[model samples]
Target: MSENDPLLNDPLLDEPQARRRWWKPSFDRRRILRWSLRGVVALLVIAALYYPVGMLLVHKIDDDPDFQAPATPEGASRAVALAAALIDREVGDYGWPSNDPFFMPGWALDNMPNYQQGIIAALARFSTEMRDQIGRVRGTSQVDPDLEKAAGQLSYSPTVWIFDFSTSWAPTASSEQQYLAAAKTLRSFNNRLSQGQAVFERRADNLQGTLDRIAADLGSASAVLDKQVEEHSGDWVDFQADDIFYATKGRLYAYGLLLRDLGTDFAPVIAERDLKAAWAQMVETFRVASTLDPLVVVNGRPDAFMRPSHLAAQGFFLLRARTQLREISNILQK
Candidate 1:
């Protein structure tokens, strides 16, 4: 009998057919197509909702302004981000980057202090970034402790970053003209010599007043000494007393001379000359004072320091100081 023959269809076979399962039925093309279409539609809806959201995420991960600081704002940063994405394609582990340096160690930059010869003009970009960061911090007093401390030690003027015409020359850019104008306004220098001259005279007068007080104190002390000596007609000689008395008198005389010289020096600072000239000269003198190296540690001598650090001397520490200053000044500007 044939397999499809009715004679072969036994009662037991019919019983098994009666207990049939629906889920275990043969696969259907229509069912598969329907499910596939449903899946695709779901994906489309999700993508439509997340397209802008994904853009935001991408921007945050790769194009964050803070992350790209000290970098040029042109196409280079975008190129970097694209190149990063392509590199991730080849390496399965690097596909989705985590900002954690530990997880994505490839981004770790090496030898920031070292120069690269094979890569020509690599440092050019970094220096350009630094120049830009410096300009961004104007009018704000965001002070970096490290840079402030370092600049304070060197007496480097914060305003010098803007004011020093010789060194603070603006770059050949449109923005620089504005900076130059600001610098000029901030200076607002007067043409006449009278103002600084007047200030200098006041300082000199103060010195004179101080000198008069010291003179009075000394005179009173001197009279008392003379009267005491007169009281003792037959003096029991005190050798140490004479030494102490003479030393005190000598100190007073030296102090008086110092005050007189200071007054004399101050008299010239306010001399009635070209007012602009006086201002310029006074500013220059203050600049000179600011340039004096700061004494970081106390030495036995008045001008001596235990350890000296400066921009030219301790370059590494100075770099750190500069970075701190950049951050501080940025905050202040905001």
Candidate 2:
């Protein structure tokens, strides 16, 4: 084992031999380094194989945006949405974040629906102003009814694309933990909507029961009051009749006052419970849904939370409408 040993004097000692250890890979370390060194080359091979170069696959399974409403107001939501749209407009048409460079760029998916929807709104306004140019060409609009129809139909259609980016798609801080958090957020939001609906249905049922009880009470009380008047009619036949008449009028007045009191007490509560509260709950459903990357075509290619073009915004609206409808139907049934 001595450095000056006769074995070290051999010609083999002049050069290093390729060696392997049980703990290490058998291939030449250099060969392993060769693949590592060929980084871009390996990426190119992967790109060529599962190319997203064709129609941009803007989505996988897009959830409804309402359920994932960002924790913000309408104006703030619009601003966030516009920013998202701007990114998509600037980035999506070029690629579906297929470049991987901008795919999960911090705020992209976070601001998907509102940000991108805002983009669509801006583009629609621009397109609207440009629509006047059609007047310059006489009868041209008439010739293309489909174009005219499309223009008219485009009035409210706001297209939006939503993509659900899991930590699986891209690395995040403690990806497993982050995924769990995102999943929890989704489940929590969903549960909130569910609980809200449950609350609404229960309130509706309770109110219906209250009304039924009130009606029964009113009927029973009316019968007793009417009988009291009828029994005393003989005291001063005509006088009792008039007093009875006035007493019944007072009783009706009392009944009406009680009903009014019940309604006045409950109206605001119902408003909050049913409409405004339901709406807020529903909005969250849209929010969650919007967080999803809804795919839309731009320049004949699908794109993600891309810029606020007509296509992207309209996609959002469609998605929103679909979600709202589902929620409405669900709430109604509940």
Candidate 3:
């Protein structure tokens, strides 16, 4: 059409020019794109800063002068509760029978008749501490010696008599003779212990289940203690915070030994199966467990103890480790 045509001469004649103008980038478009890019960059910067800031804040809060661990009786109660749960899941809730090799009379280690009896004492103390704390919470002061005794009787240990008795003596004839006699006496005991450990090792699912149960128990106890701290703040005024920290430290120390024994039992299997990643994950889990030591609560004051945070952290670390351990178990199962 001619440019001078009536339709072209009309106001709508500029429509093509307007369309071309619209197609061209304007200052507004440039400004918008620039701001959009800046916004995207700003978001990335914030995302990058998020983790470091969070970690620093956590460190500062944990290191604050007011930071305190849970009260002693509370920690003791948790330890007892977790131990009881672990025992209940592995052995019978009432513990192994008197005739079991891992039981008191048969729990000897190189003539040490009462070798793992400390486990019994600690198990019994769970009830003692729990009752004592619960009593104090309710304005009472009494303990059931009978209950403590009964708890001890119900204590169990999977690793109690699973030692290498063959290595207890040399390969000489005299040693062999002595070992023969000892071995004869312990044949039934050794067989039973071996069978128990074998059953545990035969399936990765079993190990995973054990770790999952332990982690669940620990997490549950930590949550319960968190609730207790909130509910019984008045009861914690003189609850001996340092003593609790030290006691927890002691528990962690003992746990280190348990971890060592576990590593010893499973490391070879992991190596044999060429499960390097699984082994590393297990190592990391143990490392996290080790972090729950004296350094976390040694110098903190009683009133300043962040009971909820500390317990939550403890439970979290355990759960993380348990996850890794369960992964290892899964790998072995595969």
Best-performing candidate as measured by TM-score: 3
Candidate 3's TM-score reads 0.34
Instruction: Pick out the ten consecutive residues of candidate 3 with the lowest summed lDDT.
Output: 60-69
What are the per-residue Cα lDDT tens digits for candidate 1 across 270-301? Answer: 34322334333333332232223332211122
lDDT winner, 1 or 3: 3
Candidate 2: residue 134 Cα off by (Å): 32
Of candidate 1, the 10-residue stretch with the lowest lDDT total is 111-120
What C-alpha lDDT do the candidate models reach, one value each? 0.29, 0.33, 0.39
Using all chains and alpha carbons, the TM-scores for the candidates as numbered come to: 0.20, 0.18, 0.34
Ranking by TM-score: 3, 1, 2
Q: Is candidate 2 or 3 superior in lDDT?
A: 3
lDDT of 3 by residue, 1-334 (tens): 4555555456864867755655676578788999999999999998777655643432210111111222223112223223333333223322322123433332222111121222333333433333333212232434333333333343333232333354554333231122223212222222333444211232334334444444454455445435544554444352333333333322333333333334444455656677666655655554554345443332222255453334434445555655665566566667
lDDT of 2 by residue, 5-47 (tens): 5555566544233122223445688977887879978888876
Per-candidate alpha-carbon RMSD to the true structure: 27.6, 27.9, 25.8
Is 2 or 3 the stronger prediction by TM-score? Answer: 3
Sorted on lDDT, best first, the list reads 3, 2, 1
